[model samples]
Target chain A: MKVQVLYFAWLRERIGQGREVVETEAATVADLVAELRAREERYDLAFSDMGAIRCAVDQALAPVETPLDGVREVAFFPPMTGG
Target chain B: MSEADFDLGAEAARLEAGEETGAVVTFTGRVRGGGGLRRMVIEHYPGMTERALTEIAGEAARRWPLSGTMIYHRHGSLAPGDRIMMVATASRHREAAFAAASFLMDYLKSRAPFWKKEETDDGADWVAARDADEAALERWNE
Candidate 1:
């Protein structure tokens, strides 16, 4: 499936890219993350600690086990600090 | 009435308009200057920020018999003493209003997609997440 990935805050800085389009064969969010983490050194560093990153599928907060079927967008960021 | 803006007086007036609401809880978050933070700038993921906040407000409404709710968050450049955001919940009793308002703010602090950049005398850095925020969200665990 084709998915748009977004990184925010420190994740963006570490990865050196704010957003990207990835075509992955993974069926779950965790699977996709694993695939991305293996693609490059920066990806590995950015996603090294899963506990520090939060995921949202199509703008809704999702657990790591959430399925990615039909998901067009997946955003990864550090936990938000908004008011 | 459910709306988000940057005006405090209008929100206070709206909260006081209803006779059924005996309590109004308001929370104003401001930029803290003393906490190793020199200058603060807030950035939001435009559409996503609004969606998350609307969902939070809807959830608060569903959880309480609130007379009204108003959320105001400022975007763009901000410095110390600047108002960052505010949440107001009006209900029939103080307890419900206060609890709901606090719940909403806690949820927003961790769930919403807003980023802050703190410029210190040394350099500019993005704000880091705190463990306290995660603990705050745990209060609403099912």
Candidate 2:
């Protein structure tokens, strides 16, 4: 499946990019994350610790177990502090 | 009533217009100077911010017999005098309105995907999470 990935705040800074389009065969959010982490040194560093990051599938808040099939977008970032 | 650039007086009048609602609670948050920080730039994950906010409002509605609720949050650059966000809740009793309003604000503060950049005279820096904020959320646990 093809997914558009987005990075926010420090995650974007660590990855050195804001957004990208990736083609992956992963079925779940965690699987896709693992795939990204294996891509390069930056990706590995950006996703080094999932505990410090949060994921959103499409636009809704999602857990790592969330399925990725047919998902058009996936975003990762630190815990939000917006009001 | 729903509005973006809300007028506080108008919102209060609307919330308490009818005799049916006996209590109303509102919380208005302004852009703080961050001690000595000059300006603040708030960034949001466009689509996700709205979704999270709507979900929070929905949760408040589900938890209380609310007559009305409103949340207005501003994006982009803001200074010390600017209004950051507001939450107004109306119910038959003060307790529910107050609790829901406060709960909604706390949840929005931590769970919503918005980032703030504080600009000082020296340089700009992203705002970090406060221990107080985490503790505030802990209140819901009890």
Candidate 3:
């Protein structure tokens, strides 16, 4: 399945791109993260500290363990700092 | 992302238009100037941001007897002292108006997809989410 993946804030800066489409067979977000981390040094570094990252599947906040059965979009970013 | 300033007076007037609007509460947040700050830049997920903000406003209306509600947030480059965002809630009584406005603010602070970065004389850094902001939501949970 192909999913539109988004990065924001420092994550986008570190990853060098704000958006990308990835074709993956990973069932869960964690699995997908692992696959991306293995791609290059940049992905590995960007995703190194999961504690500082947040994920939203299909525009709704979700856990990293969430399964991507029919998900079309996923976003990763640092915690929001809006007001 | 909009760099335009929001019209607070107009928004307040709109909220208070209805006859039942006995009270209207408005909250505006401005960028603080200090520590040699140069500017602030806000980034947000386009599609998710609209959805989140709408959901939050709807939730506030459902939780209280609000006659009307308005939420306006600005993105892109912003200077210190610029109005970043505003919320207005109208109700039959002051209590409901106040509570709904506070609820909207708390939810917007953490739940919205917007991220802010502070650019200073030394360097630029993404603003960290405060523990207090997360804890503010706890009081609203039933």
- In order, the first chain's TM-score in every candidate is 0.96, 0.96, 0.99
Q: After TM-score superposition, what is the CA distance of residue B101 in candidate 3 from its true location, in Å?
A: 0.7
- For model 1, report DockQ: 0.70
**Which regions of candidate 1 deviate over 4 angstroms?**
B1-5
Model 2: lDDT to the true structure: 0.85
Against the true two-chain complex, what DockQ does each candidate achieve?
0.70, 0.72, 0.93
Q: Write the per-residue lDDT of candidate 1 for residues B29-62, one digit (tens) a residue.
A: 9888786667787777656788999999999999
For each candidate, report what fraction of the true interface contacts it reproduces: 0.81, 0.75, 0.90
Residues B14-103, model 2: lDDT tens digits? 888678898999888887765777887777888888888889899899989999888778877788877788889999999999999999
Candidate 3 deviant stretches above 4 angstroms: none
Residue pairs clashing, model 3: none
- In candidate 3, position A71 carries an lDDT of 95
Please, what is the TM-score per model? 0.88, 0.87, 0.98
The per-residue C-alpha lDDT of model 3 at residue A33 equals: 96
Q: Quote the positional error of residue A79 for candidate 2 in Å.
A: 1.0
**Candidate 1 chain A, which ten residues in sequence have the lowest lDDT sum?**
A74-83
- Which TM-score value belongs to model 2? 0.87
- Model 3 misses residue B24 by how many Å? 0.7
Instruction: Give the number of colliding residue pairs in candidate 3.
Output: 0
lDDT, residue A14, candidate 1:
92
